[model samples]
Target: ELLLTTYAFCYHFQSDDPLIKLVEDYKWIDFFDFHWRLGIDGLSLGPILLTGLITTLATLVAWPVTRDSRLFHFFMLAMYSGQIGSFSSRDLLLFFIIWEYQWNLIIHT
Candidate 1:
């Protein structure tokens, strides 16, 4: 799934352009007047791709491990999701939330 998604993103990615905004909504936040925003650019693309590739490879490599495998994969995928979220997030609060979520997943995993 990740590989295919990454491939699609790469196919559509344009390095010379600024970030592409995927979402923007002020209605989701009522306090501090912040909007929920998400975007991706060349600056963030590297980390996003790296995170996806590494997580996918790690999952493949760890496939033979049978000790609490489900839990391990769950946390791993959760961490990856948080990382992707952080990379794409255009809002400070959302980035921080994802950062903390990734940290917590790391601790629990």
Candidate 2:
């Protein structure tokens, strides 16, 4: 599933519309007068692909392991979610929140 998503992402990416905003809202919350925002662009492409590829590979590599495999995969997925969120986030607060979540997942894992 991730591999397909990654391939689609790469295949559909357009240089002309590089900077794509996923979210923008004034009612989300104002932190220091900043609203929540999420976006992706050319600069973020590398990180997004890298994250997807690495996580997919890691999941495949660990698939046969029997020791606490469910927990491991859960954390791995959570970490990936946080990473993707951070990479695509345009708002500083959202990025920081995801960053902290990833950090915690790493520590616990």
Candidate 3:
């Protein structure tokens, strides 16, 4: 929902902007992407929004899943922590750490 809505909004907003149209209409820039019709339409804002929302809701939902409240909480917290790290990471190193953390939880769980 967020992705599609943001993409639609951005595309429509830039549809009338001269600068956006200039880049889209350029020959050289358009040549390499000739076969590829899709391009960044300034809708990257959607992912930014969706990532945050997913991270937040996932954390909230996972909290109640672990009721043993001792060792079980560790995996829940660990999983949530990894999810947050995954969402915030632009760097490969941190993302890998988070990815591994989740797998670690799955194995232990």
Q: What TM value does model 1 have?
A: 0.83
Stretches of candidate 1 exceeding 4 Å from the true structure: 21-26
lDDT tens string, model 1, 1-109? 4777577576776777775834454545677776777778778878987888888889999999899988888888788888888998888888888899889877865
Which 10 consecutive positions of candidate 1 have the poorest summed lDDT? 19-28
Task: Show the lowest summed lDDT stretch of 10 residues, model 2.
Answer: 21-30
Q: What is the lDDT of candidate 1?
A: 0.79
Candidate 3: list runs displaced more than 4 Å.
1-67
Model 2 spans > 4 angstroms off: 7-12, 21-26, 30-34
lDDT of 3 by residue, 1-109 (tens): 3455455555555644433221222232444442211222334334545654665566566677655766665654565556544644544544676689778778877
Clashing pairs in 2: none
Better candidate by lDDT, 2 or 3: 2
Q: List the global CA lDDT of all models.
A: 0.79, 0.77, 0.50
Q: Candidate 1 vs candidate 3: which has greater TM-score? A: 1
What tens digits encode model 2's per-residue C-alpha lDDT throughout 1-109? 4777566676776757746734355546544676667767778878888888899889998889898988888888888888888988887887898899889888876
